[model samples]
Structure formats: structure tokens, C-alpha cells
Target: MRFPWVDYVVSGEADLLIGPLCWDILNRGRDIPPADLPFGVFGPAHREAGYPAASTRDLVPRAVIENMGDLPLPDFSDYFAELNASLYADRIHAGLPMEFSRGCWWGERSHCTFCGLNGGSMTYRQKPARQAAEEMIEMSARYGSSRIEAVDNILATDYLKKALPRLTALPEKLAIFFEVKANLKRHEVEKLAAAGVRWIQPGIESLDTRVLKLMRKGTSSAHNVQLLKWCRQNGVRVSWSLLWGFPGESDAWYAEMAPLLPLLHHLQPGPAVRLRYQRYSPYHYTAEKHGLKLRPAVSYRYVYPLSERDLADQVYYFEDSEDDDVGGHFAAGSANRRPGLSAVAKGIDAWLKAWYEPKLSMLSMRDSGDEIIVEDTRAIAVEREHRVRGLAREILLAADEGSPETRLREQLSGTNVMQAEIEAAIADMIARKLIVRLDARLVGLALWHPYTPIPPMTAFPGGYFDRRAAPLGTSRE
Candidate 1:
């Protein structure tokens, strides 16, 4: 009842209303018959059975389409027309937003604690693989845009194995982007890059496995690192964020992980921000269970001069009592702000700055047939090259996607390399910052050589987009 004066608040089923309810309201007066309304179209104002519509939460969602293959391609003629008429016309390389699926497959099984995505019902659905690929290519050609970013929560698993293969053979070079899971194998990453997937957002919130576990992001720090390594090695760019303020996380985890950030200067670094309470997130649905006391976010009090009950019912963002106001919220602020978090935040800032320098930091591990060459230029004066031989090289290669010490030992056992030598090699690599270990998992951080020459795949290439975003005209306004 935020606006009790209004008669109806249409929540969902825009499709159903197109020919019926909309026509009724447009042609006739504001007399919409309840009998003709579709499911999720009407609800009681107070969760009961009556007239005035209820909030989106209290109402049932409209029927979802089983197969989204029949869904028509989005018409961007109006958007482009308006953009062309503006001062910034023809300058903006508009990335066409496409979709292959609805709801996250991972979320259907295990939802991320802080993410309120896919609504309450996390039912995974996707179009036929061949159909999806055809639609993407059609859209790209139709819109005259090479970059097509998928709007799906998490990319459909089938799309990678089936759909992406089709794109690899396409005549035009498409720069596609998708939101993927972090536990991507080396081969999977290779497939993505080969299929012209130029960018990805893997949703890597924290590097520490403990912190990751706390967020229910079934991924380890090593897994995250390997993804970065492979992405950098290929021409693919990675977009991720560092989030803190989970219930059971420790500052100690960041302390262990922060000092090692300099070792990863060659890789991309995401902004570190604290978690915010979203409407349907686990933290919001079960606040007391997670030891969080939520209030209707401090700013909402000023925005809407309503009672606590009304405020709670209205606002989507809620803040925990334990949270600090200075660097709170999901902005590009707050480098975690705590003890170890301070170091991590600073490291990320440093990493971001390093990318813009005249001579960028280089840390690449190239594997020749017989030996491996590891060159380190991350340190100012410690520009050195090390030739890896025998078991050490094998260990590094084996730890491509990051592996447990025991698993690596077992995998290399047939090589007749002693356990002592393997341990020493791993420890030495860790000490030298060639590979990092978090909770016994080791992920080697280094770049690989791509087939073609491309600019360094650094995160947020300072002023690159800004320069590109400049108007394509002589007049400067």
C-alpha cells in the first residue's frame, strides 16, 4: 500500500497484457475486469483476496515460457536512431545485449549468499544450442556490432560445448562476453577464447577459499587465479570484484593473500567492496541466521519519509548494523577497509595503476618442448629470467588450473620425482611468488603466448575506453 491511491500496479506478464488489459485500459476507462486478468496480474493489497493490487513479492509470478527459441530478436533501430541524432552519434561502439538462457544453473543447485539473482525460483532454462548461436550471429549482423554480451545470469553450460563451436567458424570476428563460473578448466577457457569470447565476468568475489566458501561461491582462490592466468594468456579479458563483510570470514585470509597481490600485477585487479543486503539474498531472507541485523538502508529514511514498516516494505538495499557508513555500499569505494583488507585494497589500486604505466609489468611462463621459461619484471629492479627444468617445470604445468599439493604429488608420482623434491619446488615457487597457495591449493600465476599479437589484457585499461568513447567528430563540446 505504498501508493494506496492508485488502482492497479501491474507486476509481470507484460506479454499477456499487450492485447487484452492494455487495450481495455486504453480504449475504455479504468475498468479492468478481474475475471479477464492473467495469473500474477492481480493480487490483494494486504496479501488477502481483494481489489487493490499487492506488492511484487506477495503476488505469484506469471507463467514462464518453456522454450525461449521463439522469442523475437530485440529491435535496436530506435536506440541507434536516437543515438545517431545525438552529439555522440557513431562514436559509441554499442555492445549488443543478447540472451541464451534464463536463471543460473549453479544458483539452482547452490545460490551465492549475497546474490539475489533469478528471483526466488531458480529454474534453469535455455534455448536450443544451435538456435542460440544462430540468433547471436543474426543479431550481430543486424545491429552492425561485433561485441555481443549475454544478459543471462550465468551462461548456459550447453552453450560452451555446443553453441560456441558454431561461432568459431563464423566469417566475422566477434568479440563476445559472458558471465561464467570460476571453476573453468584450461580447455574450457581455450574453447571460449577460440570461439571469439573476448571477455568474461566470472563472479570472483574473494581470492581466499575460506571467504569464497562463506559467500557460497563454490570456487577456491587457486581456481580464481588459474582463470586469470589462462584469460591473460589468451587474448580474453576478465572482469571480477573483491567483496568482503561475510559472516564467518577472517582478516587473516586477506593478510595472507594481500602481500602476494604484487606478484599478480601482470593480471587484472577488481575493485574491493563490502557486501550489501539485497532484497531476495540469503542475508536478507534470513538475517538473524547469519548474525546480521538489517535496517532499511540509512539513505532511504531521507528519500522516503515513511514509518519503519513502510520503509522496510519499499527499499531493496538494507545495511547491516555492524557495517560502517564511510565506505559502505556497492560503489567503486571501500577497499575492504579492515586490517588486511587495507593492504589488499591498496594492492588492487597499485595493480590498476601499474597497467597505465609506460612499461607495463610482465610475468609470463612459456613452455617450450623441453624446458619452461619464466620471466619476471613485476619488481622494479628484479627483472630476471629463470629456466625451469625437470620436475619443477612439470609441477608448474600440472598446477595450471591450481591443484592440491597431494594431488600434484600423485599426478607426478609416475615421473619418479621424490616427494621431498616436489615439496621443495612448490615451496620455492611460493617463496618466489611464481605460484601462490591458499589453504593447500596452489595456482601458478603467469601468462601464456597467444597465436596473434594483442594488447596486454589488463583490467580497465586506463583511458583506452575513454579515448574510444570520444565523439567521432571534429567539434569538441
Candidate 2:
């Protein structure tokens, strides 16, 4: 029995049984058998009769890289570049996700008590600005990926300033997205906007100063507000992170910060102001330094240490306090409470679809696919439908199709099938590798001569050829 790589084990396939090895068992020096693997080690476990055995021991190694010296940083950039090249090599791949840097800038100074970085130690590095920009350009050329998502913990303002010139030189058609500290200067915001940076995720953990201090966040509430205002003024979309409970927080603090909701609404409403609660996790150094202790973790609905004003505010806002004591509530309503793993995943999915994918596809169209008109139209349709559906299905479907054409077609067909029942009949034909383009030529008129093919249907034995020949139907055309 071989152990599966971490990715394969967590990928959620039934036949994909993952087991531990003798080395792993010996490393932990435990008498426990590898067969006793814990269910829900990666995530949730079903409470059914038969649960798969998973190791209860910690299997992952925790190490922080301060400096590689002679050893070079693994060129994950090249790996990702190749990955995107393969993905977008045909039908203009929109919303391609990329990260220019990793971890947080504050990691160099004071680690956020909640973050897990540098193997739970604080760390930071400045990726070469030119290298990062060139990578984006290469990705665009190779995969026609116009949208770039820089999944850094927080892209330091100074780094952005240095990277701005390089980013400004990128194709105007390309859109960039990244996270930043909420204390960006006015000039920094302007420079980012000028550089085609469209989406900004700011860590505005809380409006309460005490909470910010507790989290070891250096930025002030005033600074967060100023940055948001500046970003909004420059037409930059701000996606902010709001955290709620810290150890010393009480009902009064929550009430005091409640007014920040309207301010956030005024700054950037709807999905733009993403609020999330982060339960404090005490790592070795921070725990020892602050003498912090972990509260017994509870389920999503567990409400502990309740208060009257907190309950009243919950009722007044028509929001149900999450059963667990995690903080941050979206301004839209308390009904949007997300206190569990599933909700966090859904939120991330929504963000990628809405802000990241289309732009990436637009940038990477050249390397991924032929410049055929049919494929172009198909890509455009897929992108448009993705915007309407909020990009959730596209991200999910992208996980399935390996070929560029298949992925693009699957996305379009899946989106169309969701929007209209009429498209259901043709969806299977589009999914199976049977048909590739639709013939839309009349006797002499060839307005639709180069129509992309739809998948073949078993219901129509003649390979669904006649169905494609019928009078042109109403399309997104």
C-alpha cells in the first residue's frame, strides 16, 4: 500500500484510497497502525457506518525558509506558467488565477496571531517586480490569460509602488487582482489603478482598535477607511476582510464596530465588502509571547458567552449570531454568516469567478487556442455567462476538462444549460467529444459559416447533424 500525495488524497475521489508508510509511522514513534487514519483529517467526515481509516498523527512537516542561500526557490512560477499554457492554449481562457508573491509583509515584523506562514513562523520576501510582471506577460502570451490573480497574503504598498512601472507596461486589456494592507496611501491607490490593477483585497480585520492591536495588525481604522476611499475614487474594486472576535472583545466592542457596516457599505457595497470571522489560533512564538490560549473550538452554530446587547443587535439587524464565536459579519445582512469550511470555500469560489477568471482568459487567448472566429465567439459567450452566474460553475468545470477547447465548450454549454431549458437537449452532445463546431451556412449566405460545433446526442442517431441544420436559433448573438 502506497501513500497518496497530499493533493490526491484530499481531491475527493472514491477509489482514491490513501495510506501511510512505515517511515511515516516510525517518524512519529507511535504504536498506532497506519490503518487507523482519522476521518476528516483533511476536512469533514461522513458519519456513516464504515469510516475510512486516517492517521491521527500530524503528517505534514512544518518548516520556514528564511533564506535559501545557494539553493534556489523552487521555480513554481515556471510550473504554473506551463499549467496555464496548457489550459488556455485554445479557447481564450478567462479568469486564470495566478499569484505573484506569497505570505504577508508584516510577516517580517510581527506575524498576525492567526496566520499560518513560514511553517507557522513569521516570514516575508520581495519577489522581483520585473520577474513577476514578465511572468504575467508570458502567461498571457502562452495561454491568452488576461486576468491575473496575485494571491499574496498582503502585497506591501512599497512593493506595489516598485512593481507599478512594470505592471503599467502590461497590456491595457489585461486586468490584475491582488490583496493589500488596508493602509494604502492615496498615491499608491492611484498608481495601482493606473497600472490596470482592478481588484484589491484589503485586510481590514476590524474597525475596533483593540481588536486590531490584539491581532498585531499595525494599520488603524482611519487608515483602512482612507485606503478604501482612495481605491473607490480611482475605480478600483475593494474586497475587504473583516474579522470579529478576539480574546478581550466583549458585546460592547461589537456594538461599537457595528457602525463600520454603513461605512463599508458606502465605500464598496455587496460582494465587494467581504466580511469573515477568523478564530484566533495561537502558534508557538505568539502564544508564548502573548500567553494566548485557544478557546475550545465548537461547531458553526455554537454561540458561547452570550450577552443582551449582542443578542439585541443580532435581532435588530435581523442577524443570527453564529453558534461559534468566530467574528466578522458581511454588511449586506447577518443572514450572510459564514462560520464553517464550506462557506469559506463558497466565498473564495465566488471571488475567483467574479474577479479573477475572465480577465485571465482575455490575456491568455493567443497561446491557448487558434484565432478561429467560432472559438472566439464561444469563449466570449462562456465568459459572459460566467459573469451572470457569478463564475462558480466555470471554476468547478475547469477542474474536469483537460483540453482547452473541451474546457471552453463545457463552460459555455454548462452555463447555457443553466440559463435555459432549451439548451439541455444539446448539452450532452457538447460534453462528449462527438461534435466540435456547428454548421450555420445557408444556401449562399455564410454569416454563421464558422460556428463552433456542439456535442453529439445519442437521441439523434444521425449524430445530431440535422439538429444543427435547423433554422438558426436565438443565441447570445
Candidate 3:
């Protein structure tokens, strides 16, 4: 309902069939008669003659599954057996699906403005770390596959403390994937790789801090960048996408953020897309609060003959009526939005295309104690290697987690680096796009050299901060 439902555009005559009117149906120990179930039937069932009348208001709320461990292992033997018997000769290496957690921890605190998922029950719950790890091993052994995928909305951070470490000690390696919040630190990414988590779907919807704020993403752009950088360095495949079109977002935000995309070619890039409104999301339920008027999307008309009012309850997709503009420029593709969006789109397309190219441009650095060497072969500043050994080098590395000039100065207290020198170095790095000045703080742009065990700097040929540096901001020819 969050993504694929928004993108589904095909048309055909069909009844929208919703499965069982049960949220915790699995919790029931025995099969209940249809008469005992809530009679909130839709489509054909309600249309049948002599339909039994039942009031949904009379039914009590189903209890949420308190102990996730109470659930038995999902039966996937049938799926594998069917696959083996099918005409297809090749055996599919299936990633056994499992869930040790329910709801979203982040959502319970601050639901993303555009997220409509887990609306029915947003309370976060998870199995004990040991229980979760045991299931992973048992499922793999039972299903005869080392690949596993967690269907949980977010990876339980508790696993990093114990479960992942336990898996890391196993004799046989297992490939695992999960959706994680992108505010992960370097060691966490390393731990994930060590535990055989080869893939991750991180929630990094936008690169601009202001844009991310509109959706309450609870992560800074620098944090997201660090996650992407750390994942790439640790051999973890990241799955993410960039979204735009928030109601109060400024086109200038995109314009300002687009230039940094090329600086990130070494890292994976996800799709750049427009924001969509979905049922249960804040935008849909409380439209006027965000300066929007909701209506069923035009595509819905193709499926149902009912009026918009009748479709309101059944439909999940929606469109906003606060168009032609809002608060100056807020239309889907407003005039002010195009130039910035075009710039971002072009950059994203190039970033994605580079993965297919034989020689992709990258900005990487290796630490050599106090000295740092940077290799820049990005869309811009591809002239040479950067060598930094003094105050500039100190400032560049100190800002890795994003720090204000005052903090950089404070962190380097009693050092040879002065406040003036720190300011100059940060300005120079921002100009070179070697580091970004985001939200009044400096974040080091170069990823740590993959082969380096500790902090190191890298420079290709023309250094940005060193004395023998070429002119800064040299665009690659």
C-alpha cells in the first residue's frame, strides 16, 4: 500500500477483495466459524442473497500477539516442494521469510508523514534476541537454505548487541537482509556484514535535511550519507530511494542538494521520485492540516463505478486537491519545482548509470596517521590527489560526524589548528565538495578507504587543501 499500490496504473474491471476482517487472526488457536467473525464483508459476499446481518460495532478488538515467540515457524516446505516439482529446471534459492518483530519502533514515536504502513497497530514489539536468532538458524536448517529475509519493518537494534554476534560465530554463513534506519554507525554496519547481512533496505527517502524534516525522518542528511558510506565500505548492499514533493518543501532545497550527488558516485544511488499520499498517512487522514484536500486518484475511477464518497472507505490511493499551487508553489509539478527537480533527476540518472560503466568515478580517502590522501575522480574535482597534513587535515577528519566550527575548534583544542584556519579549511572543502556544510555543520565527504584499518585521508593528484593543489572545483572533462 505504501509503494506498489501508489505505482499500480493498470486498469480492469475487478472487485477489491480484502482478506479476512481479522488483524490477529493467526492468534486464534482454532478455526472460527464465519458467523463468529466480523461480518464486514465487501464485494460479492455482501451482494449474495440472504446475507446474514451482523454488526461490526458489537465485536471487540482482537488482542495483539503479546509474545512473538508464541508463533510457530512459517510453513514454507510446500512452497519449496512445489518449486521442485514445477517444470522449471533451475532451483530457486529462496530467502525464507520470517518476522520476529511487529509494528515500527520509529513510527510509534514519530510516524513519517508519508508513511501509511502499520496504521492498525503501531506499537513496536519484538521477540527476545535469542528467540529471533534461534528461528533464523532453525528456519535455514529446516528449509535447507542459508538465505533469510526479515519481514519486520525495522531491524531490532537489540539484535546488534547479541543476536547478530551469535550469528557471526556460526560455522555456516547465512545471508540476511532487513530494513534498517539509516542512522547506523560505522561499527554497526561492520557488524552487519560480519553477521552475513548482505543486503539492507534503509529508510533514506531524501538527501536534504529540510526535505527530510517535512516527513519527520528523524535523520540528518549527514547521518544518511554516513550510513551509505559505511555500508559501501563494509560490503553491505543498500536499498534506498530519494523522494520529493512534500507540501512545504522549497524547490531551492533540491537545487542546493543536487550538486552533492556526484560527490557520492562511489556509493549506491536509489531512485529519485515524487512523494505520494496514501491512506493512513498523516497527509491523507488530516489533509487540511498540511494544506491539502483529498480525493480518490483518477485511476480509482477506472476500477469502481461508485462515487468518490462511496470509494473513500474502500480505496487506498489518493490525490490532493490543493493544486494550481499552495503557499506560493506546491503543485505536483509546479513551475518553481521543475528547474531544481530537473537538476536532481539528471544527477540521479548519472549516478545510477555509473554502476554499469566500466570505470566509475569515485571520491575515496585513506588515512596515513596525521596525513590524509584523497582520490577524486567524481563528476567534479577530478584533477588530482589531495594531501592534507596540518590544520586543514585536522578539520577535515574531525568533521566526519558533522560538527560546527566551534566544536571542531574545541575538539582540536591545544593543537596547532586555530579557529581562523579551521574556518578556511571548512570553506575550502565545501567549495571542493570534499566536505559539505550542512545545517551550519561540516560533514567530511570522503568515505574512509575500504582497505584502511583506521582513519586515513586520500588524494588523487590535484590536492584541494595542500600547497601544491590545482585550482579547486575542477569539473571532470
Tens digit of per-residue lDDT, candidate 2, span 1-477: 112222122222121123343344456533333244333323211222233543311233222333322222223456556645774333322444655454566756776656543332334554567666666677666655466667667675555757678768655545777777776776787787777776777777665566777778887655555555456556577655555534454545555544333223224432322222222223322444543432333332256344443332222111113334233333334433423322433443353453333332210111112221211222223332111122322322332222244445465666554534324423432342112221110000011222222211211111112333433222111
Per-residue lDDT tens digits for candidate 1, residues 67-106, read: 6776778888998788778886544557788877877889
Which prediction has the highest lDDT against the true structure?
1
The models' CA-based lDDT, in order, is 0.73, 0.43, 0.71
The reply for model 1, stretches above 4 Å from the true place, is 5-7, 43-63, 324-337, 380-383, 411-417, 450-477
Winning model by TM-score: 1
Q: Model 3: how far is 240 from its true place, Å?
A: 0.8
Better of 2 and 3 by TM-score: 3
lDDT of 3 by residue, 329-432 (tens): 23346534477877888888888888547665667788888888988887677456888777777777877767776677777766755667666777777776
lDDT, residue 404, candidate 1: 82
| Runs in model 3 lying further than 4 Å from the true structure | 1-35, 38-63, 89-91, 324-337, 413-416, 451-477
Q: What is the lDDT of residue 25 in candidate 2?
A: 45
Which candidate model has the greater TM-score, 1 or 2? 1
lDDT of 3: 0.71
Worst 10 residues of 1 by lDDT: 457-466
Lowest lDDT sum, 10 consecutive residues, model 3, at 454-463
